[model samples]
Target: MEKIAQPQSSFMKLCRKLSPKRKDSAAESQHIKNGDHDKNRHIEAVFAYMDANKDGRISPDELQKSFMTLGEQLSDEEAEAAVRLSDTDGDGMLDFEEFAQLIKGDDKCSEEEKKMELKEAFKMYIAEGEECITPRSLKMMLKKLGESRTTDDCRVMIRAFDLNDDGVLSFDEFALMMR
Candidate 1:
């Protein structure tokens, strides 16, 4: 049998109440024109992939750890807040249904748009319009983001995602890390 979306939890209701209604712009209209079926499937797959333990729900701890893996340090409170916003079943965790519902209304960007955004972010890590990021530049950038890492640590971090083994991070490598 097909599962139905759960009734919205109080947290979800409150989020709805606080969220301002956006007037759809040209971009929003274009997004609507592009079908969301594939996007929905992708979101579902991602949710399942993130649920790591196959527990049918994602805990705040899992979310926090995932953020850390991506170099984003989230405080316990911040992680809990994120879970609360999406926990539409009042279970303190997110099932696939709740996850789907939570992201169903999101403005899903096109692959091209995503690439462009990644490229723009990659540009920020480059110096003097250089095409790639050296370990020194990467360390400086990470330091700017409040992450204190030694040059060796930065090199290690780059090598972790540096597919070409060129001793630096290219735009493609950076995009892979971002994705």
Candidate 2:
């Protein structure tokens, strides 16, 4: 039987940079030292893909193009704005270190901190002196969270966790939903 060759996807093309036969010098090893070995390799692959010209820096044009590839269609201003958020050295471009920081996120919040943060967020959906999120407010909050829910969807969601049948979500209920 003959084996058929499959076309390489863009992702596959990016990953090809990590072929086992590829060798890196001491300079490249420095970038790999910050993260788990396997994870660093993947990050490096993605970084290389974003550095479209292989120029070692991701300019706004390159970042914009990468977003366009993902169907996000970032405008020049939007792309520059994104770069500025992480452009630590202010060169108007992102080096691998800066890019990695942007992707890895800030994980400094502890569990208690997260709970307190969630409580604060939950409070935003409730009225003053109220300890629960009303059905209407819940619907509005869900929309703010990028969820497109109908009135029925909100009612069903509340019914699922409205332990007291008060047609609202108490902090305990909200915490359960968050978890």
Candidate 3:
């Protein structure tokens, strides 16, 4: 079969940097450290999602590595907390399936995060069709973060991250801002 080429978008450029792989993945395997990463196709994508090392099955250490891979500023306390919350099996370890289920929110999150986005549009609209977080504009950004974060909160975020002083947070900066 002939392979089809996928075009890269400006947004894809950033996601490629963050995710850096094709959406389709291979099968999953049990031998994680041996470099036999993906034995299950969906699990493989999940591994790619959670596996910073591209080494299958996320260990406690791997979870931290995953955050850093995103260039996120995560403190030890916060990272450990999130890992513990998602670790599930209580083995003090998180396998690829475990990692996938958790990020997918395992029935906890109202919706599943099936697709990945590097576009500023998706980031701004993670709140999901809410008017406050309208797509494609700087005007409603803060209100989108929700009722918990007031206008003052938005101002505080802008002040902290609007590095270029452009008044608007670019997709890269916005991703970091949520951190």
RMSD of each: 12.8, 16.5, 15.2
Each model's C-alpha lDDT? 0.59, 0.61, 0.43
lDDT of 1 by residue, 65-155 (tens): 6545434455687667766776877889988777766655333545664465456556656676578988888777666544678999878
lDDT of 3 by residue, 1-179 (tens): 00100111211322333332323222423345442332244445535655556655566566555545433444566555555665777876667656555544432322112233334334543344433222233334323222245555555555576667755555556545433
Model 1 per-residue lDDT at 34: 47
Candidate 2 similarity to native, TM-score? 0.42
What TM-score do all the candidates reach, one by one? 0.45, 0.42, 0.36
Q: By descending TM-score, how would the candidates be arranged?
A: 1, 2, 3
Query: What is the alpha-carbon lDDT of model 3 when measured against the actual structure?
Result: 0.43
Winner on TM-score (1 vs 2): 1
Error of 1 at 67 (Å): 1.3
For TM-score, candidate 2 versus 3, the one ahead is: 2
Between prediction 2 and prediction 3, which has the larger lDDT?
2
* Model 1 worst lDDT window (10 residues): 1-10
